[model samples]
Target: MSHSIAHQARPGHKRSEDGVLRKLRPLFWNQEGRLRAGYRVIVFFLLWGYGPALVHGVVDRILSLVMAPGGQWSFGIWLDPVRLAVVVGAGWLTAHYIDRRPFSDYGFQFNRDWWLDLVFGMVLGAALMTAIFLVEWAAGWVAVDSVFYSNESSVPFGQALMAPMVLFIVVAVAEELLTRGNHIVNFAEGLHSWGHLPAVFAAWLLSSVIFGLLHIYNPHTTWVSTANLVLTGFFFGLGFVLTGQLALPIGLHFSWNLVQGNVFGFPVSGKVFYATSLVRLEQRGPELWTGGPFGPEAGLLGILAIMVGMLFTAGWVRWRYGDLSVGRVRLSHCENRLQGR
Candidate 1:
């Protein structure tokens, strides 16, 4: 059998036709059975790893909201703390026992490249959010109050900036490690030979969808919220593809959430906050655009914003790394693949 053919073999064994051990490519960067399994593993981890935490968090939030409506949704201050310690420590420990992948393979390495990726992610993430907010205003879906600054939530100058910074750093690192780091890479690598496009697209779609669905478990969720979250997954996935480093996607994810939750004071997706916000907006007008209970991110404006962000990141990636043409999609293949390292 041709090792070049995906599923030509199975896990724990590689079958090569001629003796030229075919190198394994990333599924998201290739087309192979490894791609299929790569996606399955990610969905599994998301369900197993983050699913329980999300569910418990939702239940707790519900109780808290009932007990204290104002401060109920604000547990993220502690919950969202930047735990570089956790990502490195726990991820290292997991690699030691449960998984065979090396710590560095997980995209946990701290280096100059890592920092640059982080910076770009933050700036781009903020820009995307800002762009979405502007669209909302133009649509006349939301009316701003002079008091609220822009109808979104706000905090004092001191806390406003710091809170989001912390949240972004923490959430970005952890989630990226789990989703796009060693985990996704391993899956992709195992499949890359059969056909690269199939594998890559599968990984992208599966991981992204799981990212969105996880949000549905939130205390206050609607179909629109789920739809917005699905788009969010695509946005983050594009970031991951554009900058193979997990750092960039993590940065973007953190910024988007922190801005929505703390800076803007609207529900981040469906999760609301009560902590000292940097700004506050009383949404008055059409529920479709203002996002009503689901928040702006769950609205039409959110869809447009994320789509724009996706395109921008894709373009940047193409510019920096020559386009790796595959069907209608064009991405920087080597840059998007972990093993391309």
Candidate 2:
């Protein structure tokens, strides 16, 4: 957790004759003395994925040529794993081989606190979802008929749920890796090299904004919902920075959706579920308070709940790791390589 005070610039001043290269060095390279974080990030993604997408395109063309005049497989599934590998694989390779940096630098170390932190995040997420639902119900914005699980569709509810549950799990994994694990880590490393003390806010905002925008096209999305999603994204990102790994954030993301949509009888970003819950309620009116089809995530109550959760998480971080000081990461001469070994 020890890091260098990277933002500190040398005391001496240089004139224009110091050259244009000197001026440019401050922008591109980590002149403070570390491998350029931005460069590593670029190499990471390139290594993780360069031609798989084009390869997929070629496969589709071959299918069209062979199976039928115009037959083609779905391109969506192909994008899934390749995207995940681009981040997770790239991060692992960059840390272990190319950079020769410790896994802890990127928060990949799986030590004793891993499961403990993950479980804690899930519990907090579940509580946040529950609190929002309760607030809506108390305001009479939501009405409960009874505790019910539907099994009337083409697939029996009992048998049907495991897939969607698994799908949500996949979503949590892919998104956490893509945003918090890859993007934020890259930005943070770059910011650290620039000697930014509190890089968390900047990195978290960059990742969270993208996270919200990604969900902007979902069913029943609203401006309010997008903003709310951005807020939740911040909470999600907070877990990673607070704990320095993806486990806590992944756990929070998965549990929030499961409890919010499946257990609480609310639409998750617009998709409804019939999973087991203590109570089955229906939203009556007041779209803002109840969140309409977008679920409580788009509501004011949900916003308050997430802020409360963030406070709780902040407390947890203080209790577990002391103040939010990860300090600085130092690099040796040979440790600063372009490609990971």
Candidate 3:
């Protein structure tokens, strides 16, 4: 009689434990036994925010041990790479451990098609900047101050241009990885789990808004600039949504900044690069049209460029894919896992 009673109590306790787990699972884990999208996003951001500072501190300390007391380090050269590594690690860890997916699933599978799209994006970006430069020049809104100008007398012209090129490349890759690759994908997955189609639109809009907000503290930022940056984010995200690849956006971003600030001598989002430029230009047009010291991004001309770019992006998608459609933004992998496939 006592043994039978104990056995019955053990089963009852097991049932109670199972009930508790079922109740608590939804808070942190999805049905697939992976961390919920929201929690994964939170973890990714926490890593992104704090990982860089921690790594940088360690790096500085390591360098200090090897260098003279007063030796100076060139921050511009190393800062971007360090941040890039941190962000890449954050994304990788979040995808592998938390999201239960591959990091390449975040739109970075490099292949022939990806490279082709990237080249096209770069050309398109360069063309758009060239058009802007021509229009401003034709309207007498801009004046050429010098050619192959370097603000730093000690840095050679080639070095000046090369430095900014490398910087812009790093910036393009890092920003796209964090903004479109991680944020948009994660937001879409989270939202999709709740509602289907509306989630896609909401995810895009939210990510773009966040992208703009990230630049809120940039030099000479205004409401108009912020709005324009949001629009710019949408433009950058267009190719990603259509093709599920970062190649287009990353290439476009690189060339856009490279041409805007380094080639054409416009202030990149209001921060003038004092390093070097192929041409030094002076703005004489109305601030409303030219974006003034804030550069083209703050003005009507920038808006026009962005509109044209959008049309071009849509056309490219239609041409390449034979239709304009959203890619794997729905995150079907989670469904596959849930189905045990």
| Number of the top-ranking candidate, with TM-score as the measure | 3
Model 3 misplacement above 4 A: 1-24, 57-75, 193-196, 336-341
lDDT of 1 by residue, 210-316 (tens): 66777778867877788777677767766565455666687788787777766666677677544434555667657776667777677777777777777777776
Question: TM-score, each model?
Answer: 0.66, 0.70, 0.86
Clashes of each: 22, 10, 0
Candidate achieving the largest lDDT: 3
Ranking by TM-score: 3, 2, 1
Evaluate model 3: give its lDDT: 0.82
Stretches > 4 Å off in candidate 1? 1-84, 109-111, 145-157, 160-164, 189-193, 324-341
Q: Give the per-residue lDDT of model 2 (tens digit) for 201-275.
A: 587788898789978989999899999998889989887876668778888898899888767778888776434
Whose TM-score is higher: candidate 1's or candidate 3's? Answer: 3
TM-score of 1: 0.66
Error of 1 at 45 (Å): 3.7
| lDDT tens readout by residue for model 3, 1-341 | 99999988998999999999989989987667877767777787788778877988887667667665433323445555776787788878888888778888888897898998899889989999899999999999999999989876666787667667777887788778777887777777776644545666777788899889988999999999999999999999888888888999999999999999999999999897654889989889998988988889889999999999999999998898798877555375655343232
Query: What is residue 268's positional error in candidate 3, in angstroms?
Result: 1.3
